[model samples]
Target chain A: MDKKLEVRDGSVVLKVNPEFYPLDIIYSAAYVFLDKAYVLLDGDLKKEILVKLQPKQKQDLEKLGGEFLNELINYADYKHRAAQTKTIREYLLQRALFTNDPSIIPDDDEEVDYNEILNELEEDDEELDDPEGIAVPWEEKYGQKDEKKD
Target chain B: MKKKIKLVLNKNFYDKKAISQAIKDFEHIAKITILDDEFGIELLQKEPLEEPLKEEFSNYVLGLMKNENII
Candidate 1:
């Protein structure tokens, strides 16, 4: 496999293309390296993601690079599985919520009739013409002004 | 000696908040500029910044992206 990493200034820098790995995947992989190394992220977020791993303890840099690559692959796999199970997970969650919550089902087997409540409200036909326009009629105001000018 | 590095990031890859946070972290050491769309950022600092400094700044923004779920 072509190594995606390089050792510079005693720091292991891995350049992973954002197209293949994604920022979220890089974040997940970075979290795993936190305990072992002082990790830094660099590079253009659009094209690539750069991960710099400075070991907290003395260790083989080559081995560390290999380990980081493995961690990244593992996290990417996790992301794939999560996406694959999204629908089933959502369905299970919905089922669990409906089954556990008593509010979804009412007691006394009574069905609330919204139509009856709506009918009880006194109907005012005039309310339908509720004017949102200016109260004064335009013709009344303008016509009077024209008469005064005449 | 002073050095300036210009980086043009993908507009879709970053947001203002994340870029602002990254700039703030380096404000002391570097004069930074990030465009309104966050498609580019410039850094000017006395002496070249070690690779780790750039790496940390990137990670800092990445952490924010993870927290905010922008990425």
Candidate 2:
């Protein structure tokens, strides 16, 4: 019943102005509805983008139309956030890759002293530094300990 | 009888893949020639294509162009 959407037969058609709703946003929204409906888009690229939503099953046309509109808004918000965080996301990824990769470690960085590092570890370093912790030896951790050792 | 049908589609509004897909619907009976001109993109239909079918094909392409693929 919405002015922008029309219900016909068992499907819904939406005529969205490309100015308010961009093409990429439409695609992202349609991708979510793809499982429930067969989506088709068309329009004179100049002004509006026409979308035809054909349900793959029996359902209420109005509900689906509402969902599509909501999805468009949701996707648009996501796109805006993504654009805003692009630089921060890139920085985060770069930092993660740098810290986790040994090969890429900077040559100017200070050498890591194992004993000094161990001394600086928290008191629970037994659990932090070793695979099996202070309670168990290599063989015991490997399930080869004597049964009577308990 | 063979005839030529010309349909004007907006250049910025149409998708080539959808047009090709629509063309496939009538591939057995028609030959399609696409051209770009001042009035918009032109789809010249050859081989006895009916007016209604041309309209239907246009609508089909329109729907496809609107639904873009996104990740």
Highest TM-score, which number? 1
Off by over 4 Å in 1: A15-20, A34-50, A100-150, B1-15, B24-56
TM-score of 2: 0.51
Clash pairs for candidate 1: A41-B55
- Candidate 1, residue A13: the lDDT equals 87
Predicted candidate 1 versus true structure: per-residue lDDT over A1-150, tens digit per residue: 756789988879898988878877887887677667867666787876777788867888878988988888898899999999996686555446645873653344232432233234325433456476555568886988898899
Writing each residue's lDDT as its tens digit, candidate 2 over A1-150 gives: 449989986679888878888977887787677667767666755577877787767888888888999999998899899999996686556446655774653455333542233345434454466555566667767555565566
- Candidate with best lDDT: 1
* Global CA lDDT computed for model 2: 0.66
Question: Model 2: runs farther than 4 Å from truth?
Answer: A100-150, B1-14, B17-71
> Candidate 1's residue-wise lDDT over B1-71, tens digit each?
77777766555545677778778877888788874464566777755655445445555676677677775
Model 1's chain B yields a TM-score of 0.72
